[model samples]
Target: MDVPFGKPPVERADAARNREALLCTARAMIAELGTEKVTMDGLAERAGLGKGTVFRRFGTRAGIFRALLDAEEQRFQAAVLSGAPPLGPGADPVDRLIAYGRERTHFLLARQDIARAAVERKGPVPAGGPVFTQPHIGMLLKQARLGLPDPETLAFQLTSALEGPPLVFLSMDRSTAEQRAERCQGDLGALLADSWQTLIERLAGR
Candidate 1:
């Protein structure tokens, strides 16, 4: 498949191979050393390529991290959306919502280091950003039939309640951590469920 560009098709094939090699090496480095240690020079050396090649493939270290975060987000999405009951289907909406938050808390705790590394060098975090789970939160709220004056705003608040506090308290002893997370999930879920029920009743009256 010869591209119309002045260079021969072999050049394009070589370029694609180099790009693949760089991305593969970068992924390996990130998995091994975490995101913080993944630099263009390091990736280049690991890939047996050059720094220029790395930059050409990913544009910046942030770009590489973005790709990594994309992979993480996909895994999270699949787990929450399709993996199993409670987090997925086969449960009542409120129960599922509570389970989702609890599971997300656990996921974040497990992947805290990679997550921290991914966000360390951020500017404006991208909309529907790979690192943030805002989409999942919104989807759950929508499925729960939570009609908010502003769905997006409510989703942010709910997700904050789930993610923000646990990340703060994750350093506690295991028992304490579990207790706090359970309390947060239960309290928040109860509050939101009540609000959602009220909203539905009010809408019905109309």
Candidate 2:
């Protein structure tokens, strides 16, 4: 689990408690009501906190989802770091790369709504991935021992291929990405993943 660039400024004990309470409430609300239905006012009311407090903690409605997404990313990265083979460790680098693409596709597409909503109307769009992506992919490409002229560049290109496009979809036409991504949870995920595996195989010449 990569931290977002650097350590956050420490929060007071009460602020920490409030952050935890609000995140739990927000998750429940989103699960029950969906992303569009979860709002700052509604969350404050449900969580029994002040609207100003929610605003200070999250900044904007989009910030709430961003906070949530950050927490989710930490958990996802934890699984990759220590959980099991293929996505975690103890598997061939190429196999891990292939598995990462498939699993990561599912993770992003499944959270399309929240990822999209996290975008600020005025702020630059956020990438739908953790910062660990590029370096992790680069390391794996090297370990795979492919005879490429520039595995480093290819690693970056591959990371973009795996992460960037799905994110582009996330910011598309209102909620089209959300709806389509929900549908993509089945066949589309497999198609993208299969394509990734094929690309890796060809690169590996196997």
Candidate 3:
């Protein structure tokens, strides 16, 4: 008899508590001092955890931001899974796709800092954007019945299109960071949302 061999071991309760405390402390430090000022030593000191614990939990500084981004992604995914109509459920597949694209565009743009910071300088670049992107898009495409030959491939391409540009943009922080952030929330968001709506509508044969 063969047993399953790939399950991740559960975190011990004390370990989970330490992780929670560290993440909470990191967030406050980031808010007060910005992402650039956060360091492993700083985080460990603030959380009252040892440096070894921090190093063990997150092997590199990028891991800290990655962990934070992972938590935020979970919350965002939860909203997509069970929050409300259009983005959540009870809407046409085409509508949901459009809404998801719009929301995802803003989500990536707004969190560009954390997303960028999550990248390890020496590690291979991540592809297809964040978790759930391809699968979610594929499900919506299939439900929409677009008559496309390769929805799976299209999903992968679309995920890169939606997430790659913003995170990789050099212009993202060229000018005033505050101004850039404001525009992202306002005009830039509107433009991206409208563009996504147009793309989805055309694909749906609207």
TM-score of each: 0.55, 0.86, 0.81
Which residue pairs show backbone clashes in model 2? none
Give RMSD (Å) of candidate 3 vs. truth: 4.8
Per-candidate alpha-carbon RMSD to the true structure: 7.8, 5.8, 4.8
Please provide, for model 2 over 1-206, each residue's C-alpha lDDT reduced to its tens digit, 9 standing for 90 to 100: 87674454444666888998999999999999999999999999999988999999999999999999999999999988897988999999989988888888788767778887898887788864646888888888889888778888887888888887677786686567657757867566677878888988888888
lDDT of 1 by residue, 27-68 (tens): 788679876687878888888876887787777777766666
Query: Which candidate, 2 or 3, has the higher lDDT?
Result: 2
- Judged by lDDT, which candidate is best? 2
- Indicate which candidate wins on TM-score: 2
Q: What tens digits encode model 3's per-residue C-alpha lDDT throughout 82-124?
A: 9898899889999999999999888877776776677787565
Cα deviation in Å at residue 122, candidate 1? 7.6
Q: What is residue 185's positional error in candidate 1, in angstroms?
A: 19
lDDT of 1 at 68: 60
Q: For residue 132, give model 2's deviation from the true position in Å.
A: 1.7
Clashing residue pairs in candidate 3 (N, C-alpha, C atoms within 3 angstroms): none
